[model samples]
Target: MPFYHKLGKIPQKRHTQFKQPDGSLYHEELFSTIGFDSILSNAYHINPPAKIDSIEKVIVDASPVEWDAGLRPYHFKTKGLKFELDFITGRKPVLFNSDVIMSVCRPESQMDYFYRNATCDELIFVHEGEGMLESNFGFLDFRKGDYIVIPRSITFRLVHKTAPRLLVFESAGPIKTPKRYRNEFGQLLEHSPYCERDIRAPERLFTSSDKGDFIVKVKKENKIYSVHYDFHPFDVIGYDGFYFPWIFNIDDFMPITGKIHMPPPIHQTFEAPGFVVCSFVSRLLDYHPLAVPVPYSHSNVDSDEVLYYADGNFFSRKGIDYASISLHPGGLTHGPHPGTTEAALGKLETVETAVMMDTFKPLKLTNFARELNDENYYLSWKD
Candidate 1:
């Protein structure tokens, strides 16, 4: 988040004694990043936030095994993915590297225990579902097309109202609004595609005073550990900060347009250390009389491109459909399909929606991705 937000009750000043009804001082916990040098929040809790009952056990290995997928353009059909119970275990990694891991999750069951990803920030795209994201910061209602950005170490759980189909990204560093979209003071600029008003932070706090064994499945270094806390994780009475979970819907993005076909950066939605996420939504096409209204063939020598088709017609693609993921590695030149460029001539607009991730480092495929791979996708450009 680029702006400041405060929810629930807070004291007049920082580090001040905020007494509860029983006269005991409210516990103040500082949620910070980059060793207190970066964004942080002051959270006042009903009980001490670090009351550990016991280290129960190691739950499961959450690491994705890399499969040898030789460098070439590939397409994955994810519509056939099987549903799994719970949100954490349901994630099936498709592509990953040191900086980011991309996965598709079809969770049939809701989460029973709270989850805290200790090592990576999460960017979850709700492809198909409506749910409430309950976190220590507060509770946020998320629906389809919403990108829920959860920072690392946030104790949270997904309460599903319907079966969720999600595209999840685990980033090694903080996921942030593109720097170009913000000013020096961290406020979104007027020309930005989306502003603070379009971003939804947790408005309702879920303060709990219950005491007992509360299970929190924590993920750190690709391992899941079940930790038992003496008090409920959502014990925060108030919090004020920029470091919290937020929701940004794809529909709210106003597409940037030009007389000539614009590049991928114009569609950028979020940025991380090694990758940038772009959203392709319904928008007007290039107005140039000679414009093709589609992307031209280009070999991006610096990054790999992955596009997850969410909805609508993808004019540049032929075989891709909803829930299809196309990977174009750095070495290959990919563009509009064989006849797509010629077909797109004289088009006034595009009613397509997709999510694209361009990673600076090369991504490796997982076994699940290999199973869903369309072996002949690279040959689609052949006349």
Candidate 2:
């Protein structure tokens, strides 16, 4: 997040003596990034956050291994994924590299314990279902088409009202609004498609003073550690900072169109160190008399392109349906399928909704992705 926000109660000045009702000092914790030079927050907790009772055991190894998939375009159907009980355990990695890991999760049950991703920033796309994201900062209500951006080391859990179908991304760096959309002061410029008003931060703080054995599954260095604490993880009385979890819905994105077909950068919604995330929503097409509304064929010489189809019709793709993921790796020239360009000649608008990730580094498919891949996708452009 590039904007400042405050939730709950905070002292008039930071690092001051804030006493509790019992004449005890509230434990103040500094949540910072980039060695205290970047965005940070001051959170006051009822209990010391570092008071861990024990390290119970080590959980599953969450690292993704690269599959021996030859370089080519690939398509995967996520509809066949099985429903799992735990949100953290339900994620199935599909493509990954040194900088990013992408997965699809279909969780049938709400999280019973809290979870914290200690190493990577999580960008979750809510493809289906509704839920509330409970975090130390506060609570955020989410629904379908919402993108929940959880900064690394945020203690949180998902309370789902219905089974959730999610597309998750684990980025090795901080995920923020596109730099081109912001000014020198970090505020979004007027020309940006979405503004701060569209960004939803935590609204309701959840304070827990109960004492018990609370388990927080923390992910770090590709493994999950079951750490036990004597107090509730969401014991924060208040917090204020620019570095808290936030949400942005794709439906709120205002698509930028032109008389001629616009490039993919115009749809960029978020950016990280290795990749850029784009949103394609319902919008009008090119208005030029001789314009081709569909994109032109081109090679992604330095990046890999991945698109997750969420809903509506994909005007430039063929044989693609809801919950399908298409990967066009670097060194490949991909564009509108077969006769999609000719078919889109006179179209006025498109109702397509999809999420696209373009990574600077090459992505390797995971073993789980191979089982659902459409091997013939590379030849789908044949006339």
Which candidate gets the maximum lDDT versus the true structure? 1
Residue 366 accuracy (lDDT) in model 2:
91
Misplaced by over 4 Å in model 1 are none
In candidate 2, what are the lDDT values of residues 283-317, reduced to their tens digit? Answer: 99999999999999989889999999999889899
Error of 2 at 9 (Å): 1.9
Candidate 1: C-alpha lDDT = 0.93
Residue-wise C-alpha lDDT for candidate 1, range 253-341, written one tens digit per residue: 99999999899999999999999999999999999899879999999999999999999999889899789999999988888888888
Angstrom error of the Cα, residue 359, model 2: value is: 0.3
Q: What are the per-model numbers of colliding residue pairs?
A: 0, 0
Residue pairs in candidate 2 whose N, alpha carbon or C atoms collide under 3 angstroms: none
Those runs of model 2 whose alpha carbons end farther than 4 Å from true positions after fitting are none
RMSD over all Cα atoms, model 1: 1.0
